[model samples]
Target: MSIKILTILTLLVPTLSAFSQEKMVSVNGVNYHVLTTSLEQRKPSQPVLVFENGMGMGLGNWNTITDSLANDAPVFLYDRQGVEKSEMVYQQPTPQKIAANLKLLLKELKIEPPYILVGHSMGGIYVRAFAGYYPNDIAGLVFVDPADFTETKADWNQIFRTIGVSEKQIDEMLIKRLYTPLKVDSSRYAAWSEGQVLTDLRKTDFAELSSLPIPQVPILFFVGGKLEVPMERRSKDYDHERFFEVKNSSNMLRWRRFIHASSKGGALIYLSNSGHFVHRDDAAIVIGNIRMMLKAMEK
Candidate 1:
């Protein structure tokens, strides 16, 4: 059989017995649970689009936008190490390694490439790493209020230290509070929480991350205007500016730098009404921008 036929059969046959559900793929000792949807009802000639969630969020976070995008292209969303159904290994979760695992997952699933990656927050870091390592494989990039690692690390360290919390403990607590559902059994939460702790300990340096070569893929940046600061602090004249300045100082701004650093043209969109969870705050706007980006990429 032709490779295309085989690929379709592999995907369709699995859903015949039971409703097509989440599937797990193991690469380099770690397992990732991926949620996939295709609105064509049959595979299309277009490249697949991959959506990566922010820190403490999971694959389910993409549910609102995925359906709309799937109408135009195959959409795949997956949990990162220890976030959802993905298993955590002892290995460090650096950008390079995460990108490697994603590549392996795509190949193993017979998902042909030319990927358009849409990443939110820290997920942008992974997307950048993927584009750097496999430039030819990526067609475009959409960064939605992505976290700046250099800025994040500096601020995060201070916040944790001030609370007298170790980084490991902070990681665990964040995962538990944000990702773990209230109904989850205690045993599963414990296992999941511990895995996240190990994953945090395996972090890579932001400087090493920034030094990687930038890919020539079409890029888009979406910035959130709503700032998450203390109520008392909002009265300060410079609070909001300070908030954005630090954010711009981080990796996203570094990404903006990469855009200017290159000779190619790109796009940027500002979502003034939204917060850090821009997708949740305004799915229609985010989805519309993605559609516009996809169309621009075709040009």
Candidate 2:
């Protein structure tokens, strides 16, 4: 009887140990709640792709893409501080700060190198900063309708001023907006709503953001054409033409310039019927493009 019990216990130890591994961690005093899925027990040869959600979004937003990609390689998704299940730390959330947190998180979690960052909207800014700060850590980058630093800043300032919003108010609004759920989550929604007021007071400038260099990695920009009109309307008349030029070109010129400067290959794909939430709205398209990119990279 003792021998039989020892055999069962030994068999169950590995299973229990695997289940005990945590999927979340705190980096630089910020809580990052991560969701990960690995199709195989062994580490994959392909680089792990980390998905970063846009402002006001959480790791849960990438469920569809992560599910599809997990079949090929390990995939990870995480919510930034003050969002979703993550603990909110009181500080200015800039691209640089976020990048630092990511690095710390990876180190603490023991995530090996050769990472591919897939960032959407403002999340792209964070990834760009990350790549610049730790160039050796990245394998590639994919931007889904990322915000143009100069353009986004100018437009945001103007809009805020026009709406009679102070810098503090704008930050607060951002925090509130992020907390409010487009779908549903009563607890998170309330927390985000209250956190906005604190964030508004801590907003930073574009100059700080512009200091980061474009990464020298294979990149793919997936633009959503459906949101073009709204994005265009947000621009000032003086900046509208230039914004339209870049937008209409699917940001080809900017990518070209960046690629040339970095001496790396990059491409852009314009999706005609999607919005800011490209992955959510058209998961199949996003997944297909990534697969294609991966195949090309293999060659």
Q: Between which residue pairs do clashes occur in model 2?
A: 171-200, 172-196, 172-200, 175-196, 176-196, 179-192
The best candidate by lDDT is 1
| TM-scores of the models, in the order given | 0.69, 0.68
- Model 1 weakest 10-residue run by lDDT: 1-10
List ranges where model 1 is wrong by over 4 Å. Answer: 1-21, 39-45, 149-205, 230-241, 244-255
Q: Write the per-residue lDDT of candidate 2 for residues 1-299, one digit (tens) a residue.
A: 11100011111112211211225465544456766555234264567787778876877778678766766556667788778767776555656667877777666556777788999877776777788888887878888887654334345444555545577766765565444445433455533442342233224434554566665678888877674456546634334434444454635556556655555677777777887778888899889888876766576
Q: Give the TM-score of candidate 1.
A: 0.69
Candidate 1 per-residue lDDT, tens place, 155-242, comes to 5444444545567766775566445644433445523443353344324435655676666766778777777666776634234455
